[model samples]
Target: MAFALQGRDQSLVALGCRKRYIRGPRRADALVGASGPAGSGRPHQSGTQQQRQQKQPLLAEQLWFDEERILVDESFEAAEGAQLSPHLKVAKHVGSGTSADVYKLQGDGKQPELVLKMAKPVPGLRRAFQREWMLGRRLNAVAAAASELNMIIHTGPAVVSEDKKGQLVFRGTVLEGINGKSLDSRLEKDASFCDVDFIMMMLQQVLTALHKAEALVGFQHGDLRISNIMEHSTDPEALQALRDDAQTWQAQGFVSAESAALAKGLLTFKILDFGHSKINERQARSYLKLSSPNMNTPADSAPAGSSSGSSSSSSSSSSLALQRLPAAKGPLEAFYSFWYRGRSDSWRLLRSLATRLDGR
Candidate 1:
């Protein structure tokens, strides 16, 4: 099945029909702004009144403007270290999902080309939009661990202004676009293409990625299907040679980790579409560790088709609700507990692979 871009238009927002949708109110009632500088001392004033006019040393005087000015006129400056910015010129239609549209960015001298994901104008989809943005930020936050990641680098959101009121709106994000086709695309062309060797190599890569992904972000690869797995475009000749000699590679194998570098790169895939991926609200980094003793994959666990998210919320104000996961403490330990507990990202990946193979 195709992820958002390919053919799956279904959205996570649409799935949870009971969830609340924050309506877009016409105006923000109040903004917590800084107070004005202290008046030179009113000796006769009451203690309470004195507090209201308290002098500001480091801060400037209160510069209150109409509420409209705060939101409608000003664009949100990117958070201190964020890669957020206004949308670049769109080159063409890349794809559309239930909540957003993806586009190829126009070339510019200042930045490498990126893919822009713009949220649909519908207000109901805001949370889903925010969820994806947050997920990207989470992944990028730990990108130094890139040696272990397979997901694309999420640059951040696109900003736009409404034509009617000129209000600055956070439209969506910019992504590091890759030259590629989905695993599904690759499979659809040749069902028998994924021989044992190819699939096994891909599986190894997937497991490593999921392990790190769970540690840094989460376990539920909400949509772990063929469409979300990108097979980077490779030299046709090189690819044909590998495909032609799959059995040979399978039998002989690589002499070293460095051997068959080209084949590895071609078979290795990058994952995308975080719109449905969920994470811990309290501390994402600490919760999905692979070190927990209870996280091992069960030898007799139910097959991939069983439902995953079965755990309930642990505390008030926030709920984790991980998939069949035992309470995990850190990425190293957490992912292990996730594995031993009979459900994890690896399970989902294998399940998806199994389904794809069956279809093929």
Candidate 2:
């Protein structure tokens, strides 16, 4: 059988020998048809017409398929209250940065909270976002097999789709809402943590997770800072004790030795954000160039050079300087350099506290 369709301004012909139909103008909805025997009845009376009439509109209203490929326009954003699928409800934006915007979304109640990261489809930046999704998918698969690390949030498989304007977008696993406070916020309220042994333990856990990522997976978390770590306190009494000690230390210049020790023992930690992560053989030199204004620098790394007053002038100068810096040989070297710097300080604190406690 053969079929053909001619619309107001375009024509579509499906040849049985070729088994495909030609697609037309951007404004034209695809007139999908199939060809059979030579003497086929009026094309309008064919089953394809009936099927097209019976087909429901796409769930994602702005999405469509043309010539067997998904076509999405980059200019259109998802409408307010737009539904991606029957179960997924896209809500207002939760967070946004120059690189991407994260939308707070809801899936079936059976699933966890969803955070959809829509990477602003810049030509070169899409690969990094795609890499993150690949790594997240790999980690999700591994997480299903091993339950040792609770610090890494479970990331569902990554899905690639287009927004209303046909811009490619990426969505990954639904993240469970964490109840704990960010390490940055906690530290702001209690700087005494800098001196506490519990903080050292929490740091150890974070390091352990990074080590796993390095040794087992051969991936480097390109960004690591206090804001990305979450603290979950299981014991209200323990949390209160740490808070009390912080207050006491701030007021009296010191806390009771026992309370101080107990406060240090009760620290809990979780790590978040893997957007800048790099895989074993991947070249991640571009990551350093795409720095965020709010991103924290390492405690020990040299301070960034001051800008030359003009924003454009400063950016050019900074880019030139960054270009001059030597790149790490591989992901392993980058992982060690970044993780070890933080690990050394944590180990030093642990050793010092151990000595003070008479080798406890």
Candidate 3:
């Protein structure tokens, strides 16, 4: 797998991460004011009640993964006074995915090439759009904190709105255009990344970007395909810092020993098209509430088919229908199973970069 861009998803067989997705909104990345205990599950510290103080704030967004945004919807938005971008004018349909369709909207020249990603009224429809929208913000937040990555644009919130093709069938999200094709396409079209210097530049840019996302939001781009990476930009100040003080970034643990070098020119990349991403393990465990999954109890972590109770099927609420996963052992782990999982986005990044080293 090459470090390509466009965020087009790939199957993560090792992590059991699926490539397909349905479209919808997500409340995952939203910050609930950083207060007392929140989301599902208890904290990592061993505590009954006294120690569980105000460490974890309740983030309703995490529930969207287990319950598929059922806790919040358009009505929820309305009650909360969340602004909605309804009746968007789409120029044309560019592509289609397993659960959603991609379109390009006519920009007013000042900011042209905006994408209008839409999903059908299916089960995972809202989740698909919400994942890209929220995860994109998390990525952007990382870039913002780093003076170097601030120059690039990942994406904004998914202003998803329900439309009526007949009976309210169409739903869509607006995203800032990623700009450019896949890495393979870029390579075949032009050999910009054939040099070791360019490879090293790409390595640093991508490594730092991944590190920021994981560190801040506990996000895991499980479907780390080459196409998921794109040619992004970085501030000259930051790129220069990487070159002059490679040791600094190394000490911070953003880059591996093998990729301590830097390229002469600026090269930045961002992970896009998060159609197959999930929250990380440690972060996910923070949501271990009574209703959420329990790692100690295998039945609580069991899938819909294996679980003795048809809790998902037997539920009367339609929200239960949209809820994808039944149990979450930790916080985001409710979205993950109790089995062996992978958390090596950095290792995988290096492994994918190794493709360029074939026959060397």
Candidate 4:
């Protein structure tokens, strides 16, 4: 038998539905007698409407601008009257990646020169852009830490907005366009930096930066190759003081004259590119995978049509499978390939610089 259920007050018809007043089949007779289908039933109430309202998702704000007509877009234009000028002329493209291109930009009129990084939306590179944004945000949070540690240079404001195509674009965090050769470039032109002491000092400063980053943010630079380092000349008195110290150390037989001079000449080293850096735990695992080549090969590398012999063998002989992984070629290559391959050119350049400095 089909049962018809309805509410008590309003005349809301509910076909094949149970009545609110009825407890079970035993009470159905009483409920039917009290509230007949004619016009005595109450309204039908379901929580579906309220549930839908609560389940709605939030969306990010969308920004748009005109690229052709405006020298600077609306978002930037809004900041025009402010003391800090946002308008900058694209001088030249310094670098380009899968999702973004960095341009050395010169500010209009008297504004400070800036580095403008224009990001394009690519499905594959979206994650990289998002990761960079997250890193930038983290760096901003720990800006004070860097300052306290006297780490290279702290990053500035990183503004994220949309372009003419409505693609995500990021600006700000302007790296001061310093007028000097990069550390690698200087090492190539001059062998004077090859002194052991100089190299040690440079490495120490770099390590200090890494330590600061770890202490403040719990992450060391995954890619700390040379080309990312830039050099600035030191004060004459400071250089002379280092030279004097080197001579004193040389007299004591503590360090060689060449090493002392090189160390004295050491100026500054800046670490860049946090794109590949991972937290402590992830970094350890990544290092292991990178150092062992066998861990990178696919278990199904056996001929496509062949029986899964290798797979079965790999499963059976775990120790042998682990041994199959090759040793890392070199420390630099291992780190770059495992974590920063696409940006290997910078690292290679740095390596070349290090070699040249050693020869000097």
How many clashing residue pairs appear in each of the predictions shown? 24, 14, 33, 10
- The global C-alpha lDDT for each of the candidates, from Candidate 1 onward, is 0.43, 0.41, 0.40, 0.38
- What are the models' TM-scores? 0.51, 0.46, 0.46, 0.43
Off by over 4 Å in 4: 1-87, 92-100, 108-113, 120-122, 146-153, 163-173, 189-193, 233-266, 279-360
- What does the lDDT read for residue 192 in candidate 1? 49
lDDT of 1: 0.43
Tens digit of lDDT per residue, candidate 1, span 1-360? 221211122221111123222322221111111112221111133344234224211110011101101111234332322333232456677787776777776644444456766677776454345445545545543442333442443444323333344222445566666666787786678654534334444545555465555554554555566678876432345655766675654455542221242233433456777655656544443332221223343433332223323221111111111123222233534554555454444445555565656533
Q: How accurate is candidate 3 locally (lDDT)?
A: 0.40
The TM-score of predicted model 1 comes to 0.51
Instruction: Give the alpha carbon lDDT tens digit for every residue of 1-360 in model 3.
Output: 234432323333222112222222221111111112322122122232222223221122221233221111333222112323332345666777776667666643534346655565577556545545544444443433332233234453343222222111114555555444455455455433334334535555565455444554566665565556765322345544665875664564433222332221233354566655655433333333322332233323422222223123123122211123322233333343332154355655545545434333
- Candidate 2, poorest ten consecutive residues by summed lDDT: 59-68
Best by lDDT: 1
RMSD score of candidate 2 (Å): 27.1
lDDT of 2 by residue, 1-360 (tens): 222222221332221222222221121112222222222222222454344424422111111111111122334354457664456666777767887776776777744445566667666455555455445544443333332233565444333444444333443333444446786675466433333333434444565555444544455565566666776543446556657665653453332322232233333455666665555432222232222222233323321222222222212222211222223344545665665554432243233333333211
TM-score of model 2 relative to the true fold?
0.46
Which model, 1 or 4, shows the larger TM-score? Answer: 1
Query: For model 4, what is the error of residue 71's alpha carbon versus the real structure, in angstroms, after optimal superposition?
Result: 13
Off by over 4 Å in 3: 1-88, 109-112, 148-153, 162-170, 187-193, 233-267, 279-340
Worst 10 residues of 4 by lDDT: 59-68
